[model samples]
Target: MKFLLTSGGIMNKSIHDALVGMLGKPIADCNALCIPTAMYGHPWVGPGVKAWEFISGKEENPMVNLGWKSVGVLELTALPSIDENRWKPLIQETDVLLVSGGDALYLCHWMRQSGMADLLLSLNAVYVGMSAGSMVMAPNIGEYFVGWTPPDGSDVTLGLVDFSIFPHLDHEMLPGNTLAAAQRWASGMRGPAYAMDDQTAIKVIDGVVEVVSEGHWKLFKP
Candidate 1:
C-alpha cells in the first residue's frame, strides 16, 4: 500500500501533485472510499454535522471533495455486523481510501475490529490519511494526542510506518500546537518523528519516505 499522510487533507498543490503521482492517474479517473468512523469517536468532531460535511464534501478539509470518479462511505464501525465478502472486494477494487481525522486510538480500534488493519498490507490502493487518520499509522500517538482510548488502554497504533507524526503544527486554531509543544511531544516518542503544518504531507512508496510540503515541517531524531 502507498501512503499520502497529511496534517490536513490535500490542502496545497504540492500535496495534490504527490497524490496524483501516487495514483498514476488523474483524481477524476479513480474510485474512492471515505472512512468517517474516526469522527464519531472525537467529542469536538462529531457524530453529527461534521461527519456529514466530510462525507458530503462540504468540510474545509479536502478528502471527499476531490472530484473522484466515484466516492462512497466505508464506515468502519458498521463493518463488523456485515459479511466480509460484501466489503472486501469494494476495498480491493477501489483506487484509494480517504481516511478522515478524529481520535487516533478510536480509529485504530475500529480498523482492527473491522479487519481493515490486516487487509491493508495486501492492498494495492493508495491510502490518504488526514490528521488522526495519519497518526493511526504510527507505532504510538504519544499520550498528548490520546483522545479516545481503546479497551486495553494503550497509545499504540498500527505501526505501519517507522516514524510518528505531530500534525497541524502551529495552526492558528490550535494555539497550543506550537513547535515547542511538538518538541515536548517528540521527547516522549523516543523515535524518529515529524512536526508538520497543514500544507505538509509525508509520502511513502515502497518503503521510501519523502516530505512533500508547501509550508513548513521539521524532523526530530531520538
Candidate 2:
C-alpha cells in the first residue's frame, strides 16, 4: 500500500507530481480513482472535479477517463446507504484512490456506517489524502480544529496507520494549540502523533514513513 497524505491543499498543484513520484510512471499512468469525501455539498467541487479530469483525460464530470480502462468518479452522498457490492467493481478496476479533504468525523462515520471501512483498509491500493482525508486514515483523528469535529463514541478511526495525524497545521485556528492538543490527546496512546503543515505531506511506503515538501512536521510521544 502507498499513501500521500498532505496538510490540507495548501499546494495541490504538486500533489499529482508527488503521487507520480511515489507510485512510479507505470501506476501513475492508470486512471485516477478520486474519492472527494470532503466536497459532498460544498460550492468548490469544481477543483476536485477538474483535477480528476486533468489527470485521467476525462472531459465530463460524470465520466471516468481511464487511459487503458475507463475512469469515473464515485460520488458518495451518505456512506451509510451505499452498497458494498457496487464498490467491488470500482475498487477492483480502479488504479488509485484519491480521498479529498472534508469533515474528518463525518467521513469516518460515513465510512464505517457504509461498511466500506474494512474493505478500504484491506485493499492494496494507492491512497491519496488531503486535509481531512489525510486525518481519517490515522489512528485517532486530530483534535477538532479547522471546523472539523471528531465523531462521538468509539468512532476513533480506521487505524490504517499507527499514528494520530493533524492536517492543515499552519491554519490560524490551529497554530500552537494544534500540536499542544495533539500531545495532550496522545498522552495515553501507544503510537506517536504527527502534524503536517499546509503545502507539506508525509509519504509512507512499505512501512517506512518520510516527510515530504519544505515544512516542519511534528511527532509526539506519550
Candidate 3:
C-alpha cells in the first residue's frame, strides 16, 4: 500500500506529482472514496470544525477538484447501517482512499468499529490523507498539540505506519501546534516522530518512507 500523508491536502505541484506518481494512472482515470469521519469529533464547534464543514459542503472537493474522475463519499460514521454488498464493491473498485483531517482519535475509533481500517489494507490502492487523516495512519499520536480527545480505551491509531506524525508545526491559526511545542512532545515520545507544516507530506511506499515538502519539516527521536 502507498500512503501520501500530508499536513494539509496537496498544496503544490511537487506534492501533486508525488500523488500522481503513486497513483500510477492518468489523473482523470483515478476513482476516489473519500472518508470524512474524523471531522466529526466536535461537529458544529470550534473554528477548525466549522471551516471543514464549509469545505465539505462545497460541490467540488479539493481532492477531486485536482482531476479525479469521480469521488464517492463513504461516511464511515454511517457504516453501521450501510449495506455491505453495496459499499464493499465501491471500496474494491476505487483507486484511492482519500481521508480528510479532523480528530485523529475520533477517526480511528469509527475506523475500527466499522472495520474500515481492516478493509483498507486488503486493497492495493493509494491512501491519500490530509491533516488528521495522516495522523490516524500512525501507531500513535503521542500528546500531539493538546485538547485532542482520547479514544474510549487507548490513544492508538491505525498503525499503517510505525512512526508517529505531527502535523501543523508552527501554524499561525493553531498556535499550540508550533515547532518548539512539537519538540517538547517529541522529547517525550517513546519512538520516532516527524513534525511538519501544512506544505509538507510523508510518503510511505511499502515500508520505505520519504519526506516531500514545499515548506518545512523535521524528524525527532527519543
Candidate 4:
C-alpha cells in the first residue's frame, strides 16, 4: 500500500502539488476507487465525497483537485449499511482505495463497524490516505490529541498498521506536543511505530516498509 498522509485539508496549492506528485501518475491512468472515510459529519452526506471530488478533479473546489476518475464512493459514517457482506466484492474491485481527511476517531469507529478496516489491510490494492484516513490505519488513533470519543458505547478499529501515523505534523497541533505525545505512545509499542509529517509517506509492499516522500519520518522503538 502506498500511503500519502497529509496535514489537514489540501487547503493550499503546495500541498496539492505534493499530493499530485505522488498520486498524479497512477490515478491519471485509471478509474480509481475513492473512499473518503474520514469526513463523517452529521447529516453525513457531503463532506467526504465532496473532498474527493475536488482532489480527483471530478469537480471544482478551492482545495486540491487531481483530476482522477472517482469510480466508487463509500461514506463510512453511514455505518451498518457499509458493513454488510454484499459490499465486500465492490470494495475488492477498486484499483486503489483512497481515503480522504476528516475526524480520526469517528473514521476509525465507522471503519470497524463497517468491516472495511479488515478488508483494507487484507486487500491487494493501493491504499491512499490523507489526514484522518492516515491515522485510523495506525495501531492507535492517538485519541489524546485527535479527541476520538466513541458515541458513548463503542471504540473499535481494524488496527491494520502497527504504527501511530502522525497526520499533518508540519501544520497541525503544537509541534512539541505532537512529537512528544507521539514519541511517548511509540515507546510502548511491541513492534515498529512511526510518526510521519505531511508530504511524507511510508510505503509497504508485501509487508516490507520503506519511507517514500518529501518530508521527515521518525521511527520510535522502545
Candidate 3, residues 31-51: lDDT per residue as tens digits? 887877777774433336444
Candidate 1 residue lDDT tens string, 30-59: 999999989999998989999999999999
**Clash numbers, per candidate:** 0, 3, 0, 5
Q: Is candidate 2 or candidate 3 better by lDDT?
A: 3
The pairs that clash in candidate 2 are 64-71, 64-72, 66-71
Q: What's the lDDT for candidate 1?
A: 0.95
Q: How do the candidates rank by TM-score, highest first?
A: 1, 3, 2, 4
| Candidate 4 residue runs with Cα over 4 Å from true position | 1-25, 41-64, 82-86, 151-156, 172-178, 188-191
Preferred candidate (lDDT higher): 1 or 4 = 1
Candidate 3 wrongly placed segments (more than 4 Å):
43-61, 145-151
Error of 3 at 192 (Å): 1.1
The models' CA-based lDDT, in order, is 0.95, 0.62, 0.79, 0.58
Off by over 4 Å in 1: none
Please state every model's RMSD to the true fold in angstroms: 0.6, 5.5, 2.7, 5.0
